[model samples]
Target: MTIKRVGILGAGKVGIVLAGLALKAGYEVRISGSGSVDKIDLTISTLVPGAIASENAEVVANSDIIILAIPLSRYKNIDPTLLKGKLVIDAMNYWWETDGIREEVLDPTLTSSEQVQNYFKDSTIVKTFNHMGYHNLQEEALPKGDPKRKALFVTGDNHAAVDEVTKFVDSMGFDQVVHYKLTDGIMTEPGSPLFGASLKYQELKQIIDNFDHTDFGRKISSTLN
Candidate 1:
C-alpha cells in the first residue's frame, strides 16, 4: 500500500517531531490537537512549519495514514467511525503519572495498543514510537547504515501493515529491527525493559533476545496465556 499523506493527532512534542520527520520524508503531514485548530495553529507553525493544523476530523479526512499521539486517557474519545478502515499508528503509552491509573488500559491481558485496536475495531492498528522518550527520539535519528542509528520495534497482526510501517519508520531515519503480532507487542510497552532505550541495533537486539527472561516479560507471558 502507498502511504503519502500522514495525519497526526496530539500536537505535543512527539507529534510535532513526527510530523517534521514525515515532512522530511516527503510525505504531506497534517496534525490536530485536543482543542481547536486556532489553539494549535501557532505551535504547529513554529515547531512543524509545513504541517497543517486542523481539527481531528479534518486530519483523518485528508490523510492516508493516521498517527495517534494523544494521551492514552483520551483514546476512547477518538471517534472510531471517522477512521474506519484507516491504517492507524498507535504511539501512546499509559504513563500513570501523566495519564492517571487507567485500569482498563492497564489490563494485564492486553497491551495498550490492543485496547486501542479494540476501540477502533474497524481500523488497522500498528504499534511503535511509544517506547522511546521524545527527547531521545529527537536526537537519535541518523541516516541508514550509520552506526549510531537506533532501531525501532513495529508490531501488528497484519504482515503487510508491519512491512508498510517498517518503511515509514525507515523514512523517519530509524531501522526496523524487531516485529511481532500486536498482542506480542508487550515487549515494547511501558513496563518492558526495552522501553525508553535508545540503543543501536545490536544492543537493542540483545535485549529483545533476553526479554522473555525478564520479570515483566514473564508476567506478560503468563497473563496473556
Candidate 2:
C-alpha cells in the first residue's frame, strides 16, 4: 500500500512521538487514546501541529497505515474488522510492569508480534519502533544521507508489507533498514539487548550478526532460527 495517511491507536508518549515523525515525513496523521477525542485534542495540537486527534474508529477508517502504540494488554480491545487488509504496525511490547504480568504474551516460542499478527488476522502486521524508547525516537532522527543517522529494524512475514514499512522508516529519517523474519522479533523484545539499542546501522548490524551466540539468543534458537 502507498501509505499517505497514518493512524495511531495510542496517544501516549510513543503515539505522540510517532505522530510527530509521520507528520515530519509528510504523511497525514490521526491519533487516538482510549479516552474521548476531547481529552487529547490539545495534546495533539501542541505536540504535533498538523496531526488530527480523532476517535479510534475514525482514525482506523481514515488511515492508510494503523500503528498500534497502545499498551500490549489492551491490543485485543481493538476491533480487527476495521483493520482488514490494512498494514498494522505493531509497536507495542509486553512490558510486565505496564501490562501487569500477562502469561499469554510471555510465550518464548512465539514473538509478541506473532501474537499481535494472530489477533489481527486479516491485517498485515510488521514489528518496528517498539525496540527504541520514545526519547530515543525524538533525539535520533537525522536527514537520510547524514552519516550519523540511526538504524531501525523491520520484521514482518509479508515482503511487500515490510518493504512499505522500510520506506516509512527511512522517510522518518532512520536510514538503512535492517530486515529480519517476523519470528526473529523475539530477539528485539525488552529482555534482549537489541530492544533499546540506539546505534548506527553497522553498529547494530554487529550485534544482530552475533545474536545466535548470545546466551539469551541460544535459549530461543530452536524457535527463532
Cα lDDT listed for each candidate: 0.83, 0.83
Which residue runs of candidate 2 sit more than 4 Å off their true CA positions? Answer: 104-108, 212-225
lDDT of 1 by residue, 89-126 (tens): 99988777777856755565666777889999999999
Candidate 1 residue pairs that clash: none
| Cα shift from native, residue 147, model 1 (Å) | 1.6
Supply the TM-score for candidate 1: 0.92
Estimate, for each residue in 1-225, the C-alpha lDDT of model 2 and write its tens digit.
688999999999999999998898899999999899899999899999999999988998999999999999899888878789889988898887788755654455666788788888999999889888889998889888898899877878899889988899899889654565776666677778788889898887777767745645545534432
lDDT of 1: 0.83
Ten-residue stretch with the least lDDT total in model 2:
216-225
lDDT of 2: 0.83
